[model samples]
Target chain A: MTKELLEGNFAMAEAAVRAGCEAYFGYPITPQTEILEWMSHRMPELKRTFLQAESEVAAINMVYGAACTGTRVMSSSSSPGVSLMMEGLSYIAGTEVPVVLIDVVRGGPGLGNIAPAQSDYNQLNHGGGHGDYHQIVLAPASVQEAIDMTVLAFELAEKYRNIVVVMADGSVGQMMEPAELPEMRPVTRIQGDWPVTGNVGRPPRVLTSIYIDPPAEEVYNHKILNKWYDIQANEIRYKEYYLDDADFVVVGFGTAGRIALTSVRAARAEGIKVGLLRPITTSPFPFSQLDELSKRAQGMLVVEMNTGQMLDDVRLAAKGRLPVEFYGRPGGMMPFPDDILGEIRRLAHTPLTTEGDPRKRWMDRVRTGELMLR
Target chain B: MQTEIVFAGFGGQGALFAGQIMAFTGMDAGLAVTWMPSYGPEMRGGTANCQVIISDEEIGSPLTRTPLAAVIMNLPSLDKFEDRIAPGGVMIVNSSLVNRQPTRTDVDWLMIPAQEIAESLGNRRLLNMVMLGALLQKLPVISIEALEKGLDVHLPERHRKFLKPNIEAIRQGAAFARGELTVEATPGANGHEPEVIPPTSV
Candidate 1:
């Protein structure tokens, strides 16, 4: 059974239904409130727990409680609210509790407006909560992807016994489109793997992000790097749209990826060879495929809603092999598809002989850790 | 491909519903849509607004700095959004609520006394629907037929009977349109039309 018309938030709730998560706990925030609202409305019918916590702080803890009980559980919020949940998330990461967190990112810095912005790329990619850790973050571009990624998020989180985050933005949370609902299972799986349930028959488990002081910095770095590397090898996913024959590859994620796909289609119609390399999982950055495509393409255009955040990743993946260009809008500006096509054309035709602009060069050096923030 | 608009006014004035119906109507037309309402202490008698986007393609930013159009159900709405409409956009004001007209000459202004219209219709609850009607007339992206079809789809199963008059309102609004705005076909492969429908001028 499938429904043709559904809202993005509703679609995510539907994904939650399919995943059979035990609880849906969250606080309301712009662009993201719909998910909580939908769950609240639909939970009763499904006989699931839907609690609107007092604050994001309480909401994340509720998810932690449910997850600790060894049940599939999830929570979500926008940027500010997610920031509040980071402390709890770090704890979840430490204990390796399998819970999914959806960050429907909006603009940032302070109490930024409720609009879609990918400014949190660094936050989720680097594990914004605190301590030495990282969260599995998946970026979804369209409404359908938001739902699809949601099911995959739960699967990955449970498989690794870790925290999985479906990082989206206001656009993904608020948009409505036609989506085919996936099927539901007949068997009600017993969710009893929680770390803190302390059930009589199972061994008692503890969940915490606390780690005593490690003896050396290198030890911690190596330990974390191993996990990140594992994620990189096993989880890296990038979508290539008409990339088999292309002069340029537009690298983007989330909403930008959708726009880039549209651009690729338009460029193909005009006889210009262009394709898009969409990063499905941002934290587990897909560098291998990008490395392979770098030899074939003349240049790479990295588009983002942030200023040169992903451009750094593009450079890392390409290793200075291809000329890289960046086109971005900060705070809350979404680039038009025409602008994306224009960038692709300009970057594809332009030569790579130049060392790029002085400021851009300086910024790249600053970004690469050759320089530090004052 | 998407035009995000915000309709704002007092809580009971049907401001949020105006944007919601537009979203629902757009969805019925096979266009992606989103509706968001502002909720807080300030939202009571203070101010209220709903953000809505009607799009033929995938919507990127759910929020907009400048909406393609705005409907000010009260003085605070106009005062807050009069300067925020995009260049050559439209601002439809409820004359019954706001005495002051649009101070800016950049956006097309429509002064519809919605309270009076609702009174004539024997129900003030229809203010939002009346504003919706005017918007459906002025903004031709989604057809009158589409809006009617959307109301029937969105108005709940048991109360779906209300869709008849709502559909009639749309037709009336369509008949009231003064200028000629042809129905724009879906944009070609470009996904964006450089100049599809004639730009609405102030």
Candidate 2:
């Protein structure tokens, strides 16, 4: 595949098409509006289904209708719009319908500004919808990763019969970068006994969340819970940088993680033993990995674009084994590499150097036995 | 080496498109690139800007506070981004709309009458291409050929007719910056006298 400069939203639409997505339903929302706009043209040209619903609520239900037929369906929106679809997502989760939802999150408790933000961490990852159901959340750091993850989201949704959410920020949606588009997966007909296709020759299949019998509902809840356990055990995804030997580990996810990774490398160049742990799968949360990193690193510095929402999860993953400190810039503000580097230096007790070659400083420190790389 | 750039101007001045072209050129040349625009209500009728990073290695953070270069097309953008360029960096100014020159001493500065040149060419929408041409002359971050191909990729079929004029505007701007052409005093679009200022390079 040839690499092209593609905006993240357009890349997502292309990825979904390549993944054999049959239908797309979404409402226009900033940062994510292009996904629908691009699909509005691409889907029809490919002879697939595309519709722009009047509202986010209508959009997700339309997705629900498409998913009932066992077809690949998707919808996307920003933060506030994601809130509007919570009920539909919950219903979809309860009915065990496979669908992909994309949340290009923006700052918000209300109708926030349309800049990039990770504030929806809690809303999307912590089961925003009702009931005890969970949605598989994937956070991508780069344009290419966003494409790969969107493709993966569809497969995961169908495999588990769950709602898979690709939670990116406005940065990922609006930013343009070079990425290789995946080859189109050969179109395959959806032939399953579960779909509500015609019931003339076979028994009818009904998909619904309502159960009058409490015991039956309880059993269904247990079934979903057991499936979640299987997912938790098998689907924890993350990326580690310079963690083989490090004294400090900076934990971030999504765009924050990408920035922290940049800062960690900068800090390493400045003779500070720093590393980054990025959780690619926010739902599974990479608990055991963090636990293992905590055992070796001195402490963890968790960073986010929100007001410390993911901090609680990092703390839980740390298991009280290490000091998990929080550094955040909320309300649609992104932390720069220098700011994160300062935090890493402060946490590691390393002297900050803004002048001279950082490599030479590290060499001098090593020569005098004043500091160790690990 | 990595080059961080910010293209700034008013909402409809095509600053974002300039940055997008830079990103696309880098991608066409097989260099890693990222283009991040200031996207919000401000983009509707206010100032618009976008940061572009072109690197030989994989880019870490797509945002840069201090850019290595900047293309300021209007007065407000000049005020907002003048002090943000890195020391010893380069700043390409569109001298046609901006009457003020930067006072910074620690950077390379080039002032081109991009809007006037585009106006003379009969299409003000080519102003960004003209500014881009001046920027490429100063930085040469990507080849002019790559930039042409990039423009081809971005402009849809409906807009293909403007491709020739846009490329011609870019070439003329580059030629003016390269000292291949000289400016002449001409009447401004509003019947006011425009100055025949030589391209400033320092």
Candidate 3:
């Protein structure tokens, strides 16, 4: 396939279409409105389902309903809109239906400005909705990665009968780059026995989240937990750079991770032995891999677009074996490569320790306006 | 092996489209490219800009703090982006709209009357193409042939009639940068006399 200049949102929408997505339900929001806009015409042209629901809440429930029929269904929105979908997402999880979601995250606790951010790390990875359910989360840093991951999200969602989210920052959704889209596949509906397909040839099937019996609900909860275990065991993925003989390592995911790569390369050029580890799957995070990196590296730095949301997970993975430093830009701000490079230089020169909270130390530097110095 | 360029102007001046053309040309030439626009609650006449990065290696960050080149289409764009160019960078200024000289002495400058050239070419909207031509002539980041091909592939069908004039505008702007064409001294649309800043090389 020839490469085309594609925006991330439009590419993901087209990739979903080619991946046999039969229905799409979404509302419009900045930095991600193109996805919904593209689907509005493309889905209908293909004789597939596309609905511009009254609100994000209604859109997510539409996704839930479509997923119940074992059809490839998806909905995309930014941070606040995704928040509205949380209730519906929890319902889908409880029902154990396969669904895909694209969350082009923007900054905010509420009604934040529209800009690139990774603040939803905990919201998506740590189970935003109630219950002991886990959603498989894939974070892509580039337009090409976004396309590939959108196709993979459908496969992963169905493989585990769980919700799979392709989480990206507003940058990935808004940026344009050259990428080859996948060939169109004919829409195929799942013919599995689990789907509620009219129940004509067998006993009537009931698919609902209502396990009123406490013991039975506990048993179902255990099943969901066990499936998460399988996902964790089989789905951890990450990308590594310059880690073969490094003395220090930097960890980040999504946009933050790619920006750190620029700093890692700069640090390497200056003869500093620094490397980068970018996690692709944020939910099934590469915990064991970080443990191995901890044994070899003297110190670690965790970079993010939020205020140390993923740092806690990195700390758990490092297991206090080495010092961990932190740096972040919260509330719709993105860090330049030079900013991350400054943090790398500090990590190289300063003495290492895990004695204090890394976030506190970072906050102290931020308070003094030291991080802003060139 | 890498060049970061910023296109800045008002919201309706095609700054984003100009940057998109550069990105498309770079990609068609088999280089890694990224184009990111300054998106927000922008009105039609408000400031707008976009950054384009072309690299031989994988791009880490799409946005750049220091651009290697810039196309300043309006006075506000010049005021906002003049100091952000990297040392030894190239800047193509639209002399028709901007009346002052750039304060920086370390970077090269090509002052072309982009609005005048576009007007002579029969469309004021070709101002971006003119400035883009000047940049291509100065920096040679991508070939003019590749740029033409990009337009052929990416230009919307509704505006296909302007393809020839757009190409001509680009050529005229390149000629102006090459010192083959001269812009007459005339008052700008804002009633301020246009400045004739000569092309400078550091």
Q: What is the Å distance of residue A76 in model 1 from its true position?
A: 1.9
TM-score of 1: 0.74
Top-scoring candidate (TM-score): 3
Model 2: per-residue Cα lDDT over A159-188, one tens digit each: 889999999999999888989899999765
Clashing pairs in 2: none
What is the C-alpha lDDT profile of model 1 across B32-121, one tens digit per residue?
766655644455456778778777775544555578888787776887888778888877777766766788888877876565555455
lDDT of each: 0.73, 0.85, 0.90
- Cα lDDT of model 2 by residue, B2-43, tens digit: 899999887778888788878878887888899988888877
lDDT of model number 2? 0.85
**Candidate 3 deviant stretches above 4 angstroms:** B188-202
Model 3 pairs whose backbones collide: none
Which one is best on DockQ? 3
Candidate number of the best lDDT: 3
Colliding residue pairs in candidate 1? A69-A194, A70-A193, A70-A194
Off by over 4 Å in 2: A189-193, A350-374, B145-156, B159-164, B184-202
| TM-score pick, better of 1 and 3 | 3
Ranking by DockQ: 3, 2, 1
